[model samples]
Target: TPLHLNKVRDPDDQLVLLPHGLLRHHCCYPGCPEFLRDLRTENDLDAADAGKAGDVSESTRRNGLWQHLSPKTWYYARRSDAFLVPRVHRIARGVMDEAQTLHHFVDLTMRKLEEELRGRPAYAEIQEPWLKECVTALYGEYLGIMGV
Candidate 1:
């Protein structure tokens, strides 16, 4: 069965979908930093839009690459039935490893945040604002993780 992905919404609530053919085209290619940066910018725009809406629904947000898949396609993916062609798979595997590394960095950062906040007063109860400092620390950690 051919897979169909659901429409994914961008920051402006514009519907977008990476057609299956395009996925096949790019799957084998290593993702460039510029391409990833553009995607991040688009996601930031979506977040801004959602914030302005004041009641953003989950459906309006992109959930990473999975957002490109329709429910049925996602199901197939989960079942490991949706696979890239062999040559594409080899390329995609490297991409997947990179993605995993990125995710691990994020997880480590989250853990660092938790450790830093462990004994601190809860955000609501804090008398002094520490958000800026915490954000700076996290951003520094992120940059270090990215080796930038």
Candidate 2:
């Protein structure tokens, strides 16, 4: 069957359709085999180039042209900060399973912030505080504690 990318929800889900590349969450149960095998019984899928179909990078770059080039030039640093903290927190807990410590969470959050900040200059300035807040929220929480 030709699985279209539109049918799949996300990249990881798309990756699962490839030969033996399914992402599995380890239960880490001492009794269970080192890792329990996650069986995929369905056949829906996507092509390898699904993510490259759109001009995502170009679109982001174009959108960034209007942003401030430096943090000092930003009029709403606090507003950007406010928007970032909770968004990152929710994203970290939801995506990373809240497995890492706060320090680790913050570090990862910063990395993601930088990635998003990849716009020219203004986006970076705005992303810094939001990433920091995200890390703080996720750092101490244990797995399953995220309740995301």
Q: Choose the strongest candidate by TM-score.
A: 2
Model 1 ranges off by over 4 Å: 1-29, 32-34, 37-48, 56-60, 68-143, 146-148
**Candidate 1 residue-wise lDDT, 1-148, digit = tens:** 0122223323333323232222311111123222221232366457656767785563345444433333334233222223311122232222332444545543443344444445643322222224223332434434443446
> Best lDDT goes to which candidate?
2
Model 1, position 87: C-alpha lDDT score: 25
Question: C-alpha displacement of 96 in model 2, angstroms?
Answer: 3.3
lDDT tens digits, residue span 51-117, model 2: 2566444322211212221232333334432232223444454446444555665666566655655
Clashing pairs in 2: 101-139, 102-139
What's the TM for model 1? 0.19
Q: What are the C-alpha RMSDs, in order, of all predicted structures?
A: 17.3, 15.4
